[model samples]
Target chain A: DVKVTQSSRYLVKRTGEKVFLECVQDMDHENMFWYRQDPGLGLRLIYFSYDVKMKEKGDIPEGYSVSREKKERFSLILESASTNQTSMYLCASSPSGTGIGQPQHFGDGTRLSIL
Target chain B: LAKTTQPISMDSYEGQEVNITCSHNNIATNDYITWYQQFPSQGPRFIIQGYKTKVTNEVASLFIPADRKSSTLSLPRVSLSDTAVYYCPLAGGGSTLGRLYFGRGTQLTVWP
Candidate 1:
């Protein structure tokens, strides 16, 4: 089975703290993504990488950054955690190509809380 | 990316077939319709994907019209476990780098 592993299932941080969320996929997929899900706003994309060291901003990229040091690992960083940033963070990966019809496999998610 | 609109919620009972429809009026020519289902505490799972006509797999079916303006996801014989939030997203924006935007999604509730 294809697996996407997130470093933490739940994380809590104080305001002004820097945060890191790590994701690793075993499928060797070329595309990796990070999204944050809120209660009624739905899942909003934060960042995505098409190749190692290549990253693009999604619709909502403010206060977030990403790193793709290796093919299988992608990391999301929070420069400064804020209370409004508390949400469920999801990591996903898919095969290389235009996502036209390609479905992404997602990790269980990391619920991050900022106080 | 083409924007998708769906119902806020739907209700169905066990053994009943539930259909969730999504509207993407601005879908481009190269775009494809995809659906994802997310449970209460887990990440979203892929349900089905289609470009046009009908496509069925072991788990669900996707019905797309000729105009590509809308698509329906049909889930047969629903049970309590079938309850989840279903999202319809389109792969459209100009770049082919696997970028997809998601909407609020439809919340389906299957009653026992």
Candidate 2:
């Protein structure tokens, strides 16, 4: 079965601290994405990558950056964590195609808390 | 990308068929409609997808009208487990990359 795993399921950090969230997919999909989900606002895209070393910003990319040094691994970085950044972060990957019809496999998200 | 609109919430009884409709008036020719189910605290899972006509799989059925202006996702004899937030995503045009946009999906609650 295809699997997407996150490095951490939960994390707590102090304000102004740097944070990283790691995601790995076993399906070898070419596209990976990071999103933050908040109540009423829904899931907002942060960034996505089509290949190694390639990335693009989504609707809301502020205060976040991404790295895809390897095909199966994608990392999301919080430059300096803030209390407003507290939310559930999800990582997803899909095959390289225009097929929005294709299902994206997702990792069990990381719930981050910044004080 | 085409924008989709769906109900904010709906209530249904167990063992009843539930149909949730999504409207995408500006859907392009190459765009396909995809439905996803998301439970609380979990990521959304794909339920069905279709370009035109009726498409059915093990989990659910997708029905698209001739005009392609709207689509409906039909769940057969829904159970309490069927309660979830259903999102309808519109695919980008031909040869474009897979960039998914999530809208405020419809929340379905199945009761006994």
Candidate 3:
């Protein structure tokens, strides 16, 4: 079984504060992704990394960035947390391939609250 | 990625088979259909994937027709734990890399 672990399950931060959310996967998959889930919006991709030190912007990447210093760990950084940033954050990892038909393993999401 | 349309919600009883259908009218030839189940407050879990015909796994089964415009996910004899949101996303093909576009999934509620 694959295990994707998030650093926190519930997080709270004040406005204008920089927040960091960490995720680690045990499957050694080559692709990692970060997403934010909001009511009525579903899951919106924030950032993704295909390999270490390589990252791509997803549909919603404003005010957010990602870091992949190692193969097993991916981190999402909120440059300046705001009330609007409060939402559930999810992390996923998938194996390397043509990206066709590959199953992604996800971690129990972190519920972030920015006040 | 092709946009997928599924039901907003469904109601079923325990010990009954549940089938959720998703439509992707603009699905490309190389695009594959993938199903995911997400519980409340948890990330989506991959259930099954298929290009055409039928593909069955321990969790669920995927059925796609020849036109590839739609797919059905069948959960056999579902239990209370099977209640969750089911998402059908068109994955892969062309320059999509691995980005998956998830819409408002079908919320399934299994009752006793």
Candidate 4:
């Protein structure tokens, strides 16, 4: 089974603080993604990495960035945390850039609270 | 990603079969219909995927019509643990890297 592990399960940060959320996958998948889930709106993509050092913006990328220094790790960075940034963050990894009918396995998720 | 429409919520009882339908009127020929189940406070878990006709797995069965405009996910004999938010991620095709877009899912509650 594919294992995607997020650095923190629950996190709290103050406004204007820079926060970092990390994700690591043991499956050596080439594609990693970061998404924020909100009530009623569902999960929206924030950023995704296709390969090491390559990143792309998703639908909701404002105030967020990503890092993929290695194949197994992908990190989401919140430039300045705000109360509105509080959400459930999810990390997912797929086997390849174009995984035919393959699913993106996700981590348990990190509940981030910005005060 | 194709737009998908599903029931906002559904309710079922233990030992009863639950069928959730999702409509994707604009689904492309190459698009694959996939379902994911998410428990409270957890990320979505992959359920099943299918192109057309019927596909059955140990977890669930996927039924697609010839028009491919809609799909049905059938859970046999659901229990309380089967309660969750079910999402249909009609995946984008080809070199786009199969990125999936999720809409407001169908919340399914199972009672004993």
Enumerate residue pairs that collide in model 4: none
Instruction: Write model 3 residue lDDT over A1-115, tens digit each, in one string.
Output: 9999999999999999999999999998998999999987788889999999999999899999999999999999999998999999999998876444578889999999998
Taking the candidates in order, what DockQ does each have? 0.70, 0.68, 0.66, 0.67
In model 2, which runs have C-alpha deviations exceeding 4 angstroms?
A: none
Q: After superposition, how far is residue A99 of candidate 3 from its true place, in Å?
A: 5.3
For model 2 the local lDDT of residue B86 reads 94
* lDDT against true structure, model 4: 0.92
lDDT string, candidate 2, B6-106, tens digits: 99999999999999999999988988888989998788887888889999999899999999999999999999999999999887756556877778899
* Candidate 3 ranges beyond 4 A from true positions: A99-101
Q: Ten-residue segment with the worst summed lDDT in candidate 3 chain B?
A: B90-99
Clashing pairs in 1: none
lDDT accuracy of residue B41 in candidate 3: 82
Docking quality tier of model 2: medium
The candidate maximizing DockQ is 1
Q: Give the higher-TM-score candidate: 3 or 4.
A: 4
**After superposition on all CA atoms, what RMSD does each candidate show versus the true structure?**
1.2, 1.2, 1.3, 1.0
State each model's CA lDDT, in order. 0.92, 0.89, 0.91, 0.92
lDDT of 1 by residue, A2-93 (tens): 79999999999999999999999999999999999999888999999999999999999999999999999999999999999999999999
* Reference interface contacts recovered per candidate: 0.73, 0.66, 0.61, 0.58
Q: Please give, for residues B3-108, the per-residue lDDT of candidate 4 as tens digits.
A: 8999999999999999999999999888888999999978899999988899999999999999999999999999999999999988767866758889899999
Quote the lDDT for B34 in model 2.
89
Q: Give lDDT tens digits, candidate 4, residues A1-115.
A: 8899999999999999999999999988888999999999888999998899999989999999888999999999999998999999999998774424579999999999999
Pitting candidate 1 against candidate 2, the one with the higher lDDT is 1
Error in Å for residue A1 of model 1: 1.9
